[model samples]
Target: MLTIKRVETVVSMHQQLEQVPGCGRDCLGNCCIPGAKLPLYTFGIKQTLGSNKRAHTSSDDHCVPGDVGDFNDYEADDSPQENYFLDELLLAQWEDRMVRGLFRYDVTACETKMLPGEYGFIAQLNEGRHLQKRPTEFRVDQVLQPFDPKKFNFTKVGQEEILFQFGPSEDNVSEFYEKAPVLSSPNVVAINVSPIEYGHVLLVPRVLDRLPQRIDQDSFLLALYMAAEANNPYFRLGYNSLGAFATINHLHFQAYYLAAPFPIERAPTTRVSYGRKKGGVKVYELSKFPVRGLVFEMCNSLEDLSVAVANACVYLQNNNIPYNVLITDRGSRVFVLPQCFAERQARGEVDQEILDTQVNPAVWEISGHIVLKQRKDYDLATEEYAWKLLAEVSLSAERFEEVKAECLKAAFEGPPSDSMAQPPALPNGGSYNLLEKEQAVLIKSNIHKANSMDGVVPNVGEVGVEG
Candidate 1:
């Protein structure tokens, strides 16, 4: 219950007390983090990117690699041996916190069920998650905003809420620390007191830096590393830009465990090739889904994948276009969705029923996991209802094409070659082309089928969202 101002006062008091390792407050503020000890999880990467210095250069502002030559030729390394243990430790520590009553409510007791339909959207009835004070609202028209110290941020969260510190190791070997001194600007993984799903936590990269909720290469790479280290397909991470229902303008990613697959994950996707031959990053457009999104999957290295998506995010924010990103498929696949949900809501275009439900339709909801604040919505949840509501989140077909083209140009460093003007025929005798006006060239291969289930999707673990 400590305010940020109060925490600063306590920090000054502790500084005068001979620079103690930690104060009894057990928070992540300046008072306790200097020499505080926490469990550390270190991961290894095959390749490293450029310098971390923030660049304002027109070309490198998005932090894409200067050259990604032969990235696709690189051999894939198996998941680190330590990842098995790391995943277990993550769930174990998360559950231990649950036992300690660190969350706002018992999310496990909440009713959850999968709605009946082809999409099989999941719904949860968690009325207890309602915040006593409405979440602080940020200006929804702008995507980029300066970090305001007076506003709430993760730095004010208690140390007890943090699960661990995660970062890269010195070498190619994954390592763990039972108790390690906190880094000056550690990448902290902490619990979301208001839980949306089991094991719901926030990954705050370089917490002490107090970065505004804007995606850069380094922070996005850190998020990818976490996803890779966890090595669980069900353990997915997500992001929301300031205008995309992000109440707090702090830089953080939300993650949680859901045993079942998201409908968006199962949504059929078509490969959009700019006539590039088998290298670097590949982009796919979602087909037959309520929302129109571009999926980026790695063809080269994790760094390439992270940068490609980061570039897209930078495009969205720079233009004041709000968006959401879902990092799924064990960090291999990512969905960059440019949404107009908040914009529509502002213009009174969103239906009254949807507005009445008070569902913000952030990353999780866009991915087919609807968190209901009322029992009535949960009881009446259906695939048609879910589809219609999310349909409003999508940008118009023409606008999406414009945005997608720019994203592709940004992602690939330039527009596709003119030779790629025509639709290409697949080896399977199927031809892929743009759905309308050749906006995007789509291939029919690599389709993902929906998961088959009989009844309620058992919720054995926790997943989360951050705004």
Candidate 2:
């Protein structure tokens, strides 16, 4: 096992190499040095907020011509009214929610174009870097400091104490309940504190405490339901896994309003029926997009959509793969990005040089925009550079194809019967009625006997003071 001391030593060695003369500037250190061993290629967030800021700013700075007027009008207001209503619904949820003051409602819609040289740069980088034969593994408990739920003291009633609580168990229901003002309990939609766009909101399960890392049928259905309800020509819904730019571990889906569609939304479908499952979801591969991912058109029936999403989540969870999910309201299409770079970083496999850039691509970045914190990074950022950053964090073409194939198979095959992982029980000791059929199959298949694993899924049944 890799110990903390060993990890620190390895980091120090890389830092020392960076200081060596003629070693910086993408030489990737020691790989070029005679008799030096080649280091593993890994990626990480050097500056978490830096990349996020860049993404947020890019939205405004690169607004499409038609959308520029909306941004200008928003920015022209000396003190824009915080109260925004979506139809008859008011954003009154933000009034008393925790972290309400930190929310940024004003959004600028900018469109970033891919540079001609982006493909070439990405190819060159991929050819230069040697892929690791195996990924490094570490225990979350060993790496992460114990979480203190109290660190976030926001005004939302009952939420101040449960903001960072480990799971969504019964004990935390009240606290987690207070985190977001309830929007629609039946559909489980709630207004999020952080607003990348004017109508940014979250869709969560009404009774499950499962985290985003392990999505179940109930959460998936709720997300689909909420997205469908919010469907319009100007709204998009998305999800980010625990390591894939998700600020919180809780299971939630985000929806935001866009004056104009993102590049991905408008991009023509390159390949339809890239992969499909009989009586299941059809996968489409978008052509010429900087990020590599698959898109699924929502099924006509809720049962089919639930099955497809459940199987997709099962495949991802079983492989320990992290991903980002996006649902377009206009097309009823869902985009899934199986992420490798972020997962590698979580496993302590990323290199120092990549981390130094502080570029982490979450849902926004994958959707065709990026955020850069430093002036140097922002100024240096081009279409080619942005694509290069994405390529560094994205799965290789061959691996992506393999993942796509497996996901298709899973959707049709209906999850492996031999797998021990079971759907999490609901909060009130009641199972999701919508998923009862799948749950019954698991029970008959004896999959529920498997012990709920930590990191893979939250153990909601057990309640103990973590610290």
Candidate 3:
């Protein structure tokens, strides 16, 4: 029974936070943002991956803030200079917020270790993130719930929690601002109060728009841009749909710095043929992994990959399916996981033993980084146990095949016109859409199952509950 007040404290913490520096109010709402200042990192739109673009520095005495440099100056291209947006800027700003005592807990101090096994599943015992009570206004069954302003959302968050305003520059060069006026609808990165890992933050796109927790093309691209901007493989971003362990209905993506590779990253993938021309986006299926999922890798540009994944996400949301997304390899690779753990829990089909542990397998968990609430579960964690836990989150073979066909179609062909604007039904009507829409025929040749790894079991595992 997650009370409204408790959830409010978790998301907003209005009571704990001090007054806003300039506005005297405590929140990032329109009232306090009129004159509030925040560090801004503007990225260059012309900078493409692998391009020999000269790096732009704030120290360029001739260049002023918000000024785009002359393109002719960068023609020399001695070396492919790194983008001005690097891990250091993100980390430095993030650390400053940490020094200001903005986070709810020191996630760096949390106990995290890799379980001994073939896959080496990572486990984090983060009791600080444990919340037994369900969010009152949250309808766990629906993926596209309306944004309830009365409930907790990012707008109610404090300005101090925000690291910087991230967006594209006016010209072809990157620029940083010491204190820029907060935009009315800027994409901002804020700290997750209950941090699961070091440098854990939430990328809230166009916070003022108050969009529900559903994927949009522009927002998804921003997430990819943030990942690409960091240029670090260790910093991965993840998304959890409403019913897929996303407690909040507001639109956001969770990201953190994990030096070690996720178990899912090491999983083998077989290419899926979408009948598209080569040199675009390639779709693949996870092989020898506990949770069944689809992987998207870019062959052309980030926009291509973002469109494919965003379309797949839009498809799941319209169909009322719960899913998780992992944006890895600096946003070049993405894993779309269609899950039924929440639906199974709702119907009481989940195992009692699994429910007792209270492990909500969200994006991180499904990606083989299970965050355990119990010390016993952490201590007794094993490869077999981790496999069994994630196996339950995956859709059954029959359902997955059907979903895969539809998602691939959505990814390559784009979502259907009729279902594009369809809003999700209220909880009273039940979450799953009963009315059947035209289904995409499953192309058997498109899917190829890869060989399972040695010592790995072939059986599917099913178990689910809150984490």
Candidate 4:
């Protein structure tokens, strides 16, 4: 069991301790001031306080001093409990809980190396076998299969396949649902049966929808609420769309608590304003490493968050674009990635085998951490090789510019007036529509100029698109 304790300490020798800089008070708020007693507690790490003599030394030299009093006067509740701070810090005692079970897998099993050139880093995940074995050849007609409650079981809770009854009426029922969940209400949060990382979790809607696009604002907000409840800076929340490498058809979002930051988290980002929604939710764009995507930074208002996400969903649905979304707890930042680039790569038209894997670009892969299942793929994985793979899976310069333009246009003018707008043609001889003809015309003209000057298109894996 992991036990974390915070102890209070003070200076024993008044003469040995120097007065706090710029403050006239002593170790005890105002020990030198007669007839005045101000209680102040100095919290320090238990490991640092070596003996009883050293325990009395001031933990922070800059802390203002106060009058010495009975040590018991400062002793407060030391009972094991969980405390979540506003700064995304979590303090918890795991002595009485089964916290040891949470870390059954070895985190160090995955190998990470920074690739050369533009590919930031690649994590050769030997534990990605679960994802590789998932069914990827579902028939188009069977894409939206109905839920079967009899087949559903909360196996993690128990060995028995417990059945769940959704509602009083037979018609108002769910075929399958999680009987035991970590967090539940309109949505359910449960531990992933096959987690890539320790404490990896999934947030799914109770109503049961195959596609994430079908998730309503209520369910979306609930998932975000559950993520915030984690309160740990290590955990990051994200989602993959239907065709954007989501293995399960059920509408769900994923969360994982990592000891270290993902490459994307540390990568540099350039921010650009995409304007604000009618409800005042500010929409923006973050480009460069990680993956280029539209961002919606929400305020405290739930209504504003709904509006921002609703607009983004409507835009993608209208354009027939599959996408992935990620929500970071730190800044309340939402990343919306249209899977145009990934979809193109899935065709396997290119001969490039660099960082090739069975799975397509998903939320984790787009976030600069590509997982390799095959031994050959893992062996060939390098920084430059990883960068090339991501570049191929990422939106091209021209396509990205068009996407940014459209998002900004939608933000200012409101959700598209036409929800039935057909996707435009692709640059290559394909039916894929990433932009409208007129928009493509302008983008192609700019591309032509850049290509003419350099004899090759700039940012063609050389650099990323500017925000």
Best by TM-score: 3
Regarding lDDT, does 1 or 2 come out ahead? 1
Best by lDDT: 3
lDDT of model 4, residue 66: 23
TM-score (all chains, Cα) for each model: 0.77, 0.56, 0.79, 0.56
Model 2, residue 240: distance off in Å is 1.4
Please give the range of 10 consecutive residues that has the lowest summed lDDT in model 1.
51-60
lDDT by residue (4-112, candidate 3, tens digit) is 1233445554444455454444677876776676766666655745542212221212111121123233222344436535466666666666555666555665677
If both were scored by TM-score, which would come out higher, candidate 1 or candidate 4?
A: 1
Off by over 4 Å in 3: 1-24, 51-81, 131-136, 276-279, 422-467
User: Candidate 4 lDDT, tens digit per residue, 30-66?
Assistant: 2222232111111111211111111111121111112
The whole-model C-alpha lDDT of candidate 3 against the native structure comes to 0.71
Order of candidate numbers by lDDT, starting with the best: 3, 1, 2, 4
What stretches of model 1 exceed 4 Å from their correct place?
1-24, 47-82, 132-134, 414-467
lDDT (Cα atoms) of all candidates against the true structure: 0.69, 0.44, 0.71, 0.42
List the pairs of residues colliding in candidate 3.
Answer: 1-133, 2-133, 2-134, 360-467, 391-461, 392-461, 392-462, 392-463
Q: Which ranges in model 2 have alpha carbons more than 4 Å from their true place?
A: 1-188, 207-212, 268-277, 343-354, 426-429, 434-467
Candidate 1: TM-score?
A: 0.77
Candidate 3, poorest ten consecutive residues by summed lDDT: 434-443
